[model samples]
Target: MKQSSAKQYAFSDAEYEELRRIIEQSVGIALASGKRDLVYGRVSRRVRALGLSSFAEYLARLRKGDQAELEELVNAMTTNVTQFFRESHHFDYLRETFLPEMVQRHQRDRVIRIWSAGCSSGEEPYSIAVVMAEFLDAHPGWRAEIWATDVDGAILRQAEEGVYPMESLKDVSQERLRRFFLRGKGVNEGKVRVGKSLREIVQFQRVNLIQPWRIRQSFDAVFCRNVIIYFDRAHKKQVVEGFADHLAPKGHLFLGHSESLHGLTDRYQLIGKTIYRRRD
Candidate 1:
């Protein structure tokens, strides 16, 4: 414990508060007081990487408006935990409930659009693509498109590449394994690349949720699960309200199981576990 606490640079309370405020203002991520060590460790890496001698010097650089450093700080501090199907039920709903309703609603025009906000490394969107492929197979001639977006440009590149450890697909069935992935060999063993068909349907882009969105088209569904919990109440409401504004009439919205729309917005009505629909 002593060695752990014996950080190389001195971390002061004032520095911590300043960082917390800067993070919240920049990305809308609310860094709680308990996350001091997390911030210190991540920020310290930046200081060292830049060859700065102290935390004060790093803070001085940040205050002087180093936009590139700011991006690096946020990227280092942000968490990007994901899996092929972290919440199995949401995908189940997409397959069993949402698509059927959408199919009937758009019988005349069969173009389906989906948005996977904060899609870290592309798992959620790839999972959605699998469901979409199956759906289109069942109902022929239907076209679907998905937009996978995240704030971290680094992770966005990973998502665009469509690679993952073979273990990441444990929840996936053998049939899906054959249909949606190409196994790596020799030097690349133990890794898998997402199939060409799945990659074709998704368009990945860098998007910061706190900032204004450039997308003008509405989506049939929005999967933003577990992302907004990092933001404060006001920012949470703002983002949710933005989702409501952009959703199609009675469009489905899927959030993380731990997240809720309660007291945040009244534009949505609960339809399933952590699922909601925008009110007309």
Candidate 2:
């Protein structure tokens, strides 16, 4: 399928600077001095939707707390690209280490709780479901639930549907692909859908990581992966600390390989590379 592009905005240096300041202040996403093109690309659809011709006018309206335009602006700027099993090693670690630890921790209750913060689509959470299901089959009498969330409402809606093109499974193993996915027929022949059983294991919700958040209880594991790299250092620190606070003692925190908690927070003890467990 062809990707869609938003309407382009014609922005000047001053306009770019204004946008950079506003976004950085509101969400802590710092657009560098030379990022005029990126600012234009990201904000153009808001410009077109509001019938504003200049970036200054649109930006001023946004500063006035125009909720409608601000929502669109957030949509444009938030990165939503994701697919199933994008980072396979994380799943491997979950299966080999984290799940085993969780199983032992929850032996009396036999319930494992995992939170996939900023789960772009349904892929990551569903992948977790697949892993948990396989693990449960071996253990007998263990259960797991995955809470997946994203800031974008549209993406959360798509995630709840649990449908995607079959090609999204390219990296997934054939056994998992066959076991968890239902091959679409008729008009949906080229696509696949996650079955209800797997979908039921994962609950999708819309959540803004930057805002105050409360979970039912501390999670056994939190997957706030790749999404944090987009935030500035301050936002990164705040989010990581929040995750650490919500993490159970000895719970695990997984980050993208390129991401590091070094100097950001010291609450988590480094385990394997890119994986950190909350210091008990």
Best by lDDT: 1
List residue ranges in candidate 2 displaced over 4 A. 1-9
Pick the TM-score winner: 1
Which tens-of-lDDT digit does each residue in 148-245 have in candidate 1? Answer: 99888889899999999999899999999998899999999999999999999999998889999998899999999999988999999999999998
- Model 1 regions lying over 4 Å from their true place: 1-5
Local accuracy of candidate 2 as per-residue lDDT tens digits, 185-230? 9999989999888998998877778888866588888998888888
TM-scores for all candidates: the values are 0.96, 0.91
Cα error, candidate 1, residue 254 (Å): 0.4
Q: Count the clashes in each prediction.
A: 0, 0
For each candidate, what is the lDDT? 0.91, 0.82
